[model samples]
Target chain A: MGKLKVLSVGALSTIQDEGRFGYRQFGIPQSGAMDISAMQNANHLVSNNPEWPVIETAIQGMKLEAIDETIISVTGAVVTLKINEHQVPMNASHQLQQGDILTISKPMGGVYFYLGIGGQLRANKDFGSYSTYIMAGFGGMEGRALKKGDILETQGGKPFKKHVIKQGTKPSMTETIRIMKGPEWKLLKDLPERTIFQVDPSSNRMGIRLIGDPLGIDGKEILSSAVIPGTIQLPPNGIPIVLMNDCQTTGGYPRIGKVVNEDMGRLSQLNPMHKLRLKIIPLEEALEKR
Target chain B: MNILKEKELPLLQFNKVSWDLFRLGEQSLLLQAPFDIPIEKIHDSAKLIKSVLGSLLTDIVPSYNSIALFHSFEESTIIEKLSTARGISQKKSTPIQKVEIPICYELGLDLEHVAEHSGISQDEVIDIHLNDTYRAILIGFTPGFIYMDGLDERLACPRKANPRKYLEFGSIGIGGEQTGIYSLASPGGWNIIGRTPLHLFDYKKQPPMSVEVGSEVSYVRITKQEFESWGS
Candidate 1:
């Protein structure tokens, strides 16, 4: 068995796998890794299954100490990685000794970081997922974010040869993202033809609020309906809200656009003050990208 | 049929309806019934797809007139299944269980506000709330938060102008034409009128939620002493 002790936690970090599935009808949000490819790349570095639980840290990073010898890798957004105050290479696995201190600092611009441990960390599986849905208080590390002194228990595995990620695989932190018309796309009246939006500070796992030219539409409280990640909804105030990984199962707001999965990944890594441009594309192309 | 032409569809006796299937996202598709189709048919179709798809489907979200299916590689299969679902009869050999909820009106903070807004007495509000048999149409917004219809128009009230930061768990409230109970405490804008003593949701149980979609729910007003004495 392996153990990892948390020394300091940043703004937000939680244990996540693919997500808690098969529970949306009950209104349980699917809490999963924001960027799928980045998470899998980190897992590949440590030779773990892509779906294995990993620590997802926000723009601000975390500090931890290994209580047992194991291998670890970090992915998503270029960040300063340190081991015992010495810089270490990211996107590559490194064997660690007991009591080795690991520190991850905020990225230059990215919003999410993933720490893929070599051994799988165990979490309470509610509805067959290891994700921490903090709103409901039910999964991952006792259903909340890791705090100082929180110890994570894991199944230990022998360290394999280091795995190195090829260059240029990581997605560039692009400002513009691709999107497609939503079910209620026609309702957008004053979309400001070519205006760019800035990510609002109120963004979180549930959804990201965008500050831009108001879509200039009033809502009549349409029948509550299903929504998913990448769904862009325009409320009565006309500000567009992009639903993310931890969004609710259903909503009543008017859906105006959907950021394609390829760009929802880009949207996920963006911090507040990041610029956003919606490049309207064919729905077929958006589905094809997946 | 254009949606703007209708105020709302009838409550019962809808037949031979067809739903339009639109791709929602990469892995999600929505089957929307025409405005003329009854709301109950929407739920029946959702139940059919949910049972048929089994593990192949992820989330099956049902709203007033549509069901959104989150599928993996079974898009064609889901389309095929939903296409044939209209002919399937909505029936059950087992009786649709009616879950009785115990509410303590004393615990609700907005009862007086709800009464004053409706220009009715507080007892009339409680009486009308208890008089109707609300059917659980769908579950969303939060875990186990059931969207129930069939509230009397006399008792209907709009949501609070300013939503509370945190509503107590099990707070029963009305939002627009619907009445619901919060399964989990969170910020909400509904006009709260009562509170239930039931946990309503427990993960360790066979089914986490006490109320399922298509369930018929009735309320029995209980005293605070009775609610406090109720065993887990």
Candidate 2:
């Protein structure tokens, strides 16, 4: 089996896959890679299945040492990559010899980075998912972030020819994202068409809190109802919170709308204080885009 | 005339309820019953929808008055299938899984505060809590967190002004008019009255949560020593 040891890690680096599913009814957050496409791309570069668990680092980068020869690739968020002392390119696979140190620095833009291996990382699987949910402590590397001295083993595989992904495939931080009206759309007095919402600095996997001109509406609390990723909720304060992968299964705020699935990946990559606009579209039109 | 009578009888007995369908997201739709409808009817409707959709649905999350259905089929297909399916039956199945949770009232951090606020003695508060049985209404907010109904209104207390940063698993508390147990350690604002020794959630088990919506829950008072010696 191929092995890699965590030499050092930055903030919030944990193992993530597509996400744990079919457990939201039990209140389990669908913990997974924030930027879904990036995780899939990283896996593809390493010739692994798109859903294979990968190390997801937030903001800052990490350091890993190859304990056994293996193939590795990095994707998501613009970050400087290195092997020992030599600079390397991202979105491309490289063969790592034993004892080689791989370094990834803080991202130049975006907030999350994904590092994938050529084969499945044999970590704890809870509810048929390898994704880590740190709050409850169940999945991936003892249900915690990657730390120094931690070792990860993968199913050994032969080195394959190197592969690289094309540019423009990575998600771009767009100013406007498309959305469809939610259940309580009528409760909204008006949509913020001219005003741009700023992403709150405290935003994390649970939801993206927006700082903008409060929509002056008598925001009444709805009975707790089901909420999924991308469901934009308007709290009593009128600031909207766009629910993400790790948001609670149910909430009491007025659901204004949900960002279309296609734009969700791009929305996740936006940094704090980033400007955002919502383009409300019909359900049929939104479906057509998909 | 015979066919019309048979069709009309089933619809009448079942109440032939209509639900408001809202498109929650690209892949999810929410069916909402009227507020006046019993939660049991809502649960039955969710079950009926799940049965009708079968494998087409990935999840069917039921709440007090709404059900969210997640699926990959077209919106029109789901709507069409739901309209043609048999109506939600009114048969009520009494929940038999009554879980007796042993609580240590000595561990209650807010016992004095709760007693003062409710104008009752501390011993009276514990007695009242243990007297009534509660039904699990909805489980959400966090993993395995059970939202139970049937708290005595006299014992109802406002949530803590500042929520605790960390509540141990099996921490039982009262928030507003509802009472609940923290299946996992989590930050919460409920007024803590006691804690249970049972590990309500075991990830290794097939169904991680032993109790679910509609399960009956009643608390039994135990001493701190008994709680400490629970597993042994």
* Candidate that scores best on lDDT: 2
RMSD of candidate 2 to the true fold? 5.5
Q: Looking at candidate 2, what is the lDDT of residue A176? A: 86
Give lDDT tens digits, candidate 1, residues B1-232: 1212312212222124555556667788777776555666776666667676777787788888878888887566666655565455555523566999999998878899888988999998999888889898889988778889899887778887898888877889998888998988878899888888888877887668888888899999999898788884
Find the candidate with the highest DockQ and give its number: 1
Steric clash count of candidate 2: 0
Which CAPRI level is candidate 2? acceptable
- Alpha carbon lDDT of residue B181, candidate 2? 89
Model 1 chain A poorest 10 in a row by lDDT: A166-175
DockQ of each: 0.45, 0.44
- Error in Å for residue A205 of model 1: 1.5
Q: Pull out the clashing pairs in model 2.
A: none
Q: Which candidate number would show the highest TM-score if scored against the true structure?
A: 2
lDDT of 2 by residue, B185-211 (tens): 999999989999999988878778898
Q: Distance from true position, residue B165, model 2, in Å?
A: 2.2
